[model samples]
Target: MKGRQIILDQINGREAAALMVDGQLDDLLVEGDAPRPGTIYRAVADRPVKGQGGMFLKTPDGNVFLRQVKGLAPGDVMLVQVTGYAEPGKAIPVTQKVLFKSRYVIVTPDAPGINVSRSIHEEDERDRILEVAHEVSREEGVGLILRSACEGADRDEIAEDIANMLDLAEQVLADAEGAAEKLLDGDGPHLAAWRDWSEPAEVVTEAGSFDTHGVLDALEDAQGSRVSLESGVSLFVEPTRALVAVDVNTGGDTSPAAGTKANFAAARALPRALRVRGLGGQVVLDLAPMPKKDRRGFESALRSAFKRDPIDTTLVGWTPLGHFELQRKKARQELREVLK
Candidate 1:
């Protein structure tokens, strides 16, 4: 493999060099010119200072710099990773835009469906929401759901959703300033249910405990079979997000399936397993096989079954080495937390 190197240093600690192989981090070697920029790092150091669209820039002093990237604010926190560039020059930085979007509600008119909505882009509306949230709390008591999840939501619900988030925003500020330890964050059980429903796993919360039923019932009412709770976990499989991966262990305790028919049953259920587990991305299902040709047939059947799920799913068929692969989209982060 081919590689390159970049040096990074800590102000008080020793220096180290990052090794890159094929554009990937391969190793870190000690002893190099990893001098710390020996400078203060500030995200929001300066305000626009009396202009609507003034720009910002980072000026380097000697080999040291105070980075000013377009679209970056003075107070923003940055996670900097050094990447190798072809051109020569020590530590030339190129800015990349990263949008951190939070979930929001979308509202629509004409649908009798409860709580219909479209997701909101943080860039598009967070300021307005924050401002109004303060106002709403001062006058009318309410909360808001920032609405990124409502990308395709209905019309009538949008206003109400905004109102809800605004209400929450004001409370967040008040609790912080008042130093109220008991102040809870503004998330509702309904939103909490959506968080569970957005996961790519078959969510299993303890059966009769924690109002899991209410969560499941509300999700079902709003999203239909896209959400379900059984065996102490609730399962939500949606197509709007990225794919998740699931690993089913035959648990050294249960003996493996005995025959071809049984093996076929397991293979046949791969799609459902993917759906139930919300295993998206490039799924490589390595189950006990039936036979050579049977594997292909089972994959075909599984592919067909995945169509019934509301989420978008595609089976890449079996690998030459025997493993089922699938590609799918799922909600963000929920699946990772659930699986963990």
Candidate 2:
């Protein structure tokens, strides 16, 4: 099939929304997003925190830290990767190590070798994918790690993604400039998806007939309340200023087996919903009560589902209260507000 066509449009006056006209697929929204994670921000080490053991590094956005820059002097400017968002009184966490994200690869400065995702268990396919990845950055510069998304991707797709990443690296190097300040803005949920898709895309200025995507409505809705599923289960996605809590509730008549099925479905949809909504950072998924045997199966289902997520999500295992812990790195504003 030929590459898909993408249309990017401004829905509200200030919000930018994009979609693939290959039948008005999912809408990609990315306006007024902030503190994009996985970016290299050039900042200077500022005054030391008295009892925190780490001094704040000041950037254009604000002061962020990781444990204070070693050998950091007041005037020394350092390159940091934004890890999380900054709350009312809390600074965003940052680190010296930088990871460059692409549609199919993650390039980092820490490792000099090319590493493929473990999901590609087939040894021959893994070698071929790695070879293609190496070809992308071998002569140009650093190595890149293949992401799970590249599992079934063709060489053309992989090559194109790598080229886009290499282009970004070039842009960053050129834009680094003589002075120091955030070197890269990085890609938020929308921009990253748009660029990665790279199919023939168009930007629509007016709604017209693309309303079928439901992305517009999803973006505009801000109730952020509990949503009921057809399986007689309810999902409550609550996002605080710094973290997100998802509570799963089953109906009174729901049987344990049915509840297990609903919870598994919820686990699969949770990350997709969060990514589409642009919700990020620490997340806790409180599933419906289940027996110990079922809990193991439910956790396996979660891990399987998250394997397809483009965002960096870490399943931190089940809590004593049976809540599933997750740490997805995202800093974009919620879709609820983005639509507003």
Candidate 3:
């Protein structure tokens, strides 16, 4: 309970994985019905929306909408990858850029280069990983990216991962001429946990691990709109049809710095709240009443907090009415929707 622990369990007979750190739930992944991001497909081009500059494509799953529709024509066949979950009653979001990602390596079919993650800065380690990449017999245009997890990894494991990804990329790229069909299925919760959570942790795969590890309780708390920060400060994170609205409350604190303290706490806790709820898209924060001079500090705090988060989020700055805004990617389905 002191260190990181991964609990693999079933919620409502659906596959789910929970990451717990120091007896608290840090992250959660639950299976959903939408096509998972990173799935590859050989799709046939459908009609284009003239003003929107987007094109619809016919896939085995259904019709998907692709952006940046330059140099694509109707009836043309091409390969695409699912980018993220689509809104309700909307086409699945996709992109022409496809990538084969794994724990230690990512295969880039379009970009051509061998690069190591910047986190591994030692020259000797970088050189060793580069040599391992060079040993793989990849095609001319396909590129290789050595992830940060490759640092200090076994040579054989790195080489094997690279080789496996190259083979899979070659196979998928070769089958681009077929009808609209799925070329590859994305990784499920268990596999995704293995791929992304590379750090050493205790693994629990027994039945009812969620209850045993307190993940169920954490999830139950995440389902509510109120999140308690520190010193009786709390915030309400509610999702509306258009955006997520966060209202901060200072509670019973009546000190001169109460508003500032509450706002800063909200800034630090907002990312985790949104992440656990799997809420994304536009977000508006109605922070506690604070002086204008403290706005810079609040912005800095928010930016630093989001920088450590895994999901892609953009701090879109403050509005005219003193509301802070953010734009987050739809990386996961809404927790309420998934549960229902």
Candidate 4:
């Protein structure tokens, strides 16, 4: 997290996007007028569609794809959470098995159980949270999922999180009964960054309200079009219609060891670059050719690099043309669209 920073953008005195983070542009922002991913909408189940295998739930904005049809009939109204970040002309998924997320825990109604974050690798810490769950879990049809933020949290704090979420669950249920096409509690990009990434990232902005330095100052050309890493290596980034392509060069090297080292460095840097550029769908990385033995676990390393990204990414294996492949969910509008 050495070069970690969240640089904010301002358009006519309003927040827009992150201009730079570790020498990359942030594509992780939702459009200003769009509905956020965490927004809860009260939807009525419409007539089931035959081919799609899901019913269209009607909200004020448009239809939402609801996967569950069992025990559900036409005109059945209920609460649903927006699982997919919505886009223009695109209907995202929503579910009755809603997950209420907080800084410490995720409370799910309908699916009752207690679990911990998989990212919490330590068994001791996981068990301790589970023990707290046993104490806080009073209802049968509800479940608790301890977040990674709960790692070293005090017992009282965990209990308070549980109590607060339970109250929220009750509120969501009570409000759903008398509501029609209403948005309840929600979260947006700026608030989400404040809530989840405050500790790991330094929030930097060029706005008159805030002070700026570090990553913001180091950036010479915005969007990191010309990136020179501290290790004296450079990356050539090209955004094309089909895919975003990156070329890793150690200032012109042909040796296999040099190729491997550069590829590793590129893998480490690619996530931040991708997040900054908001380049998704498919990505191709060109690295210098190395021995087959040196390629071991490189794909995993690339996937791990993207683990911090808001959207999930997958390694799609290497191509026959010697390029590495990765695909991440396009969570927001493309960086180019926002720049306009």
Q: In terms of lDDT, which candidate is stronger, 2 or 4?
A: 4
lDDT of 3 at 54: 95
**Candidate closest to the true structure, highest TM-score:** 3
If scored against the real structure, what TM-score would every candidate get? 0.30, 0.74, 0.97, 0.76
Model 3, 180: alpha-carbon shift in Å? 0.5
Worst 10 residues of 3 by lDDT: 136-145
* Model 4, span 1-340: residue lDDT tens: 2455665555444454353445444444534455566678888888787877788888886788887577878888888887654444557767676778777888888888888989889888898899988987888888888888888878898889888888888787767854356566466556565545534565665564223433333322435555565456777777776777888887666565777777778788777666655566677888766777878757666767777666788888888987888776756555545545
- lDDT per residue as tens, model 3, 213-303: 8998999999999999889999999999889999999999999999999999999888889988999889999999999999999999999
Residues 243-337, candidate 2: write the lDDT tens digits: 89898877764564766877877886676567656777789887876677888888888889888665678888877777788988765556666
Model 1 poorest ten-residue lDDT run? 35-44
Candidate with better lDDT, 1 vs 3: 3
Residue 306 of model 4 has an lDDT of 77
Order of models, best TM-score first: 3, 4, 2, 1
Give Cα-based local distance difference scores for all models.
0.35, 0.68, 0.92, 0.69
Specify the highest-lDDT model's number: 3
**lDDT of model number 3:** 0.92
Clashing pairs in 2: 5-200, 6-200, 6-201, 6-202, 7-202, 8-202, 8-203, 42-182
RMSD of each: 19.0, 4.9, 1.3, 4.3
Q: Give the poorly placed runs of model 4, Cα more than 4 Å off.
A: 1-12, 15-31, 45-56, 66-78, 86-89, 93-97, 118-128, 175-180, 198-211, 214-227, 230-232, 236-243, 308-310
